[model samples]
Target: MLKKGLYGIYKGVEFRITVDMDNNLKIMTDKKEKTDSTFEDTYQSGVYTKIVKPNELVDCVSVTPFGIIKGEKVQILQEKENKYQVATGALLVGSNLNLPRIDRDSWLGWVSKGEVKLFEEITPINPEDL
Candidate 1:
């Protein structure tokens, strides 16, 4: 049985497949939910990266309106053609100190492949320790 909140493609068109409370399969378009199907698991690891400088603005696929900032960290969720679906923090609504760090609150959107790069961590080494 097809799982709810998962994405699938049929007749070359992408769709968000969902199972209704009555167990009926419902296919919706242009809406991204929790896609956990193997068909959508194409990305290698949940690749996390930051938005490139001079941030390239692109229309987001979300229920709310917002803007992405340069250097903001995001997790690459899926990729289609030249675009990548990413998950990032939503707009700060209250005190920054009390911000919740959870997946349920993450903002999911799409970004061009050129607007992001794979993140790399660098560590300094002392000559004496070398």
Candidate 2:
């Protein structure tokens, strides 16, 4: 699990938006409970998989040494969650991890996402790169 105060970004499959995936991801949500007459139980909706760099972004430093950030975005890519959960939830959620700047566009946007293959065994990279 990621520590507190760490900013995270969303990354996952393309999730070709369609009835097939939408119906599937929708199942992940637990909205069975009825809401009060005033509002209604609609808060718990579209929750799905997320790819946090699995770590926290260190406090900003003056300059980056070298080879720290692969690019502007960082993704965990680790299967902290299960595949079935991913697919089905993808049906419901459409994306994962609601970090700062990570919106629906960013989640679907390729540039905002990361590579799962690379995150397989990623390690902490220091800004100084000793």
Candidate 3:
């Protein structure tokens, strides 16, 4: 199924990104817990992610419209029906690169792992186990 949100569907898909040891890393998230307005919870994770597409880069009548997401950049490398490659650009919201971070909020994705394409739900699901 395709996704529903504030971004675009395209000849290619969009991706959020991060770098570790100067290499691209995929974003991964795990909801730690629900709070009762008193305590805090956290999780240790090694996965990374970024969100792309489904956006037009401008808005009005919305405050924090890009809440969690501050900005987006896309480079169209080669876009086919199932494959998308691109050059890169991203920015910190409020121009605060000193403490820049990418937000993960139900962003759909497509990446080639070996000769296969992958999404978070697919790579982690057990079609047989279900």
Q: Flag clash pairs in model 3.
A: 6-54, 7-54, 7-55, 8-54, 16-50, 16-51, 17-50, 26-48, 27-48, 27-49
Worst 10 residues of 1 by lDDT: 51-60
What C-alpha lDDT, on a 0 to 100 scale, does residue 26 get in candidate 2?
14
Superior candidate under lDDT, 1 versus 2: 1
lDDT of 2 by residue, 1-130 (tens): 2211112121221211111233321111122232223222234453333211212224312221111123322333323332111111121233333323344433322222223223222233332232
The candidates, ranked best first by lDDT, are 1, 3, 2
Highest TM-score scorer: 1
Count residue pairs with overlapping backbones in model 1: 0
**Which is the leading candidate under lDDT?**
1
Error of 3 at 22 (Å): 42
Higher-scoring candidate on TM-score, 1 or 2: 1
Model 1: per-residue lDDT, tens digit, 38-72?
A: 23322544422221111121121222222233556
Give lDDT: candidate 3, residue 77. 29
Any runs in candidate 1 off by more than 4 Å, and if so which?
Answer: 1-69, 90-104, 120-130
So what's the TM-score on candidate 2? 0.15
TM-score of each: 0.29, 0.15, 0.16
lDDT per residue for candidate 3 within 78-106, as digits (tens), equals 33465433222333321332222234312
